[model samples]
Target: MGPSRPERARREAVAKVRDQILASLLSGRYRPGEKAPSVRRMAALTGRSRRSVHEAYRQLAAEGLLEVRWGSGTFFAETHPLALAPETSAPPPALPAIPLELRRLAERLELGEAGLARLVAYWAGYARDHVELAVVECNGEQRGLMARELGETLGVRCREIDLAELGPAGARLRRVSAIVTSCCHRDEVAPFAEAAGRPLFTVSMDPGFLPPLLDALARGPLVMIVRDRAYGPVLSRFLETLRLPPEQIARLAVVEPDGLIGALAERDRPGALYVSPLVRDRVGRLDLDGWRELEPRRFVARDEVDHLWAHLAWLRARAQP
Candidate 1:
């Protein structure tokens, strides 16, 4: 039998409740092993019925975002924060002025005008002052590299933590402006995207996983790094699915192993990559000479992922009349 409209609404309400709870955990408002508000309390907080909150929490606990002890109470997962990169040594840099080319490109993408408006408003808040950034990596070495990069470029404190060690702490979560995951798998990346209300960037080993991951991390910025040529066609197709314009696509920079050092060496950018031991030993041996490497961080860190965010921020700031 077909479901009734009220039932659908109730289901949606429950989903929203779950999303909010997850967001709270990602924001570090809730701590791992820390009891969440009672269902009765959450119902009052979200203005939903107790049954709705109960259903939501039950689902979340099943998903491993929360733990429920028969008599102890509900608590956030101890490792929830580990889903993202650790905090950087300092806060993110001051938001920069939105670029005009990006604004025009975003307008052409035709994201629903209302959605675009809301995005712009959000960027404005970040631009008003410094936003916090959290970077999560799989190992200590990567964390150290990220910390050093962030410290030099953003000139703010950056926290470095392994995702495997994160505990429940909502306070720490809320401070993250963005989450960057390096050399991560698709399975590991999705939950963090869902958990963190912010955007995500990944250094991907598999090109096939990039499209869906990009779609899933739709809330804010998402930058994907591809290391193989076989993945290029796949990425091109994915961009087409998103209807990205040719001119926009042209802006992507391809990196060749032979030319990578030279390319990066020429760019005196603040966050340029140096010859890390890992890259030198692994990918540097490839025959890359002119393959495009998508430097998503450059765009995302500048306050936009695709043209959409850039344009929205510009229009919103301009519309402040």
Candidate 2:
């Protein structure tokens, strides 16, 4: 009745490889007609065998998403394929038109007529007044900041919870209509949201803010002061993806809070110092003043918070009776 261990492992391998490649493309890694990372490079990054990577590439090519050359390399197709694209406007939500047999079964289960109506009313009312967006992140300050921003923009109550506190089997998760997370914590938070049957969305970055930052990075390497948590590692990978060499950019992590300034007392410092905005307030407590904000480029690029608010509003309205 169930798949064997080998079968399940193979399925997971394909899915993981597929998702990583898609994530790279969506993040604007390569230009149009530019070669994608070689199968060997991808294998190294994903920690998979080259044979598996090659198989995944072949599958994508068959799907019309990638083109492979004999000696050149694999590249993305100029046109993107969006299967059954999400419409700007969704169809009005209506209760399912159940067949007679299913309706009979519902009646037998005491879910007929008034009971069904009560269930509908409860979910609709819950969406109306009890919808709370919980942002699960490991960094407390960043979590609080995101909660504040979303609450202000969406006009809905929001809360922040640590990833450790959010489990798949919690009543707290059931109360949430949606889970909001940064791109970095997405994979970590996805399983919990899935178990709770709620949709999880990653907020995008401000595009206007990034070009100038990238311009700054292009000028020269900078030393980045990072927290020991998720933001540090995630930001590091993001910068490396943009082709900033590790040696050129000095990264400070695993240092205690407010200890960064002291740690830099005699160590090598770059021409510029970049700090995650999450720790900006902490850094301000010190006398130091020459640091630039390291924007994580969270990869969801649309800037206006109100746009996500509007989408949430749409989701709310669509849940009506």
Candidate 3:
């Protein structure tokens, strides 16, 4: 007696599903112990019958791609052996350009122009071979523009992420080379900063907090986009106390209404240190900086944000393992 047509089709479908399950597991599509899709969901996605999906899953369990946890649903096996392909010889393409709106917003906010420009130049000089960009945004309009510009300019993958949907230490955050935070909530930014050991680029309308923030970032390279000229003097004084060499100070550029330029020496460097005018004006009196006077020129501003992005890209490319 020959096997029925439906039985033969079911067998073939099971084989196909088994192969897919094995491939997905090997590629880390589903982490160990993570639930495999339900039979109905798998059927819907794969366009196969539910019964066939169930049978395929059973076959995969038998072959060790999955484990059936009795009352629990099926899961990718914890100890499944992964077969990795050989490393590709060819390198990835450059990152894309900034979108018009983001370019405008970043220009408007004056975020990290010097650092980002330095980053791009650095990447071109050093790696020139492999550089990827990941832009994080909560809004779709901005996200789409960034992704498109970056993809077109750099030829690298650009992804958008909704901050509201992201959890602490989410998988998407771990996959990026660097993070560009745009209008993200303060609370959300804090946690991502903690987890993002990589370079972070931020733009802000408020320049008052920048000095101390950059001070804290002295341990790492921090790029701040300053939109207001009023705060430049205060930032200049803060840098003067650091006493960095003229060459090092040159790296700091001001992004003003005009063009990007290095830190100015005209600002007064009083021996006595005081809190920033903005801080002082707001709080009346709070000693954020210690009484000790540090040299000025620590905070440099650039007129363009692209310069900042280039700088950061350079730093990140060089830092790569």
Candidate 4:
């Protein structure tokens, strides 16, 4: 009784497009009073449908972040809204904006108000039967972080598993109510997602990913000080997002500053040494006078996590058992 597969997929797509637009605005790519790019241009930039882009712009306009002018295109508003009217101050509408397809199906079935309410309750019960979420990730470190993030955000039980652990066409995946992952692993995890027939959602980097990471990268070539060797691959992936090649970014596996200093003493590499929080704290205590340690320890963005939370809320509210 949960949302049909196509219904869920479309909503996810729209939500992602909307989030991407918000990310651009929050990242300062489109400033206040600036003419936002055309809907077609945004669709191409984000690799989403033009309809989705227009829908996102419409949503933003309603929220006062954007203004849509006929023939003039959309523009970022001069003043952003600080807060929306409280829910208690407004009367609830009799019907929410259900999808057209869903509405047609309901009409064909001739479902009355009471019948439709029962139908929703039945789906909610169906969703409740499988409450555990499976977070598909490429590496252990990424998986652990994804699980913790989603668990805290969604207030649901979440466990980390690699694509291999998902087991194509198996019982293990069937128990999961949803599948969530980092934006990077979406392709690798898609097949298993189909095999499991569960909803899949991707989390993105927050607007915060730019300033700290970009500022640090501008000062590269950086030597990464990994907290654990297992985190090397994920960190390496993040580094590749920079303009430089992989070889320019080096790593020192030890979690201590003295080890970093000793390693550096033996090498003649250029640029700064970027330490993870675990190592950064310890580095502050040591006197490695020549080494420049960058302070962008954690790179996850607020809006990035917001997308994953929005996906979870969709499942609970619209795809509920």
> Would you list the C-alpha lDDT of every candidate in the order shown?
0.47, 0.56, 0.46, 0.56
Candidate 3 yields a Cα-based lDDT of 0.46
- Residues 1-321 of candidate 4 have per-residue lDDT tens digits of 245788667666766876566545443466678898887898898888888777667756755668887888788887642111222232221223222332343355565443334333322332233356887766655566566555544445776776666665356666676777777778877777776667787876556544554455455444556444556666656667764455444532323344565566655644556565544555564346565655553344545555554444322233222
Comparison by lDDT, 2 against 3, better one: 2
Rank list by TM-score: 4, 2, 1, 3
Which regions of candidate 2 are displaced past 4 Å? 1-129, 138-142, 184-188, 209-230, 251-257, 266-270, 273-304, 314-321
Inter-residue clash pairs, candidate 4? 123-320, 123-321, 124-320, 124-321, 125-321, 126-321, 127-321, 206-301
TM-score of each: 0.30, 0.46, 0.28, 0.46
For model 4 the local lDDT of residue 27 reads 37
Poorest 10 consecutive residues by lDDT, candidate 1? 312-321
By lDDT, is 3 or 4 better? 4
**Where is model 1 more than 4 Å wrong at Cα?**
81-321
Q: Residue by residue across 253-292, what tens digits does model 3's lDDT show?
A: 3333222213223222211232322223332332323223
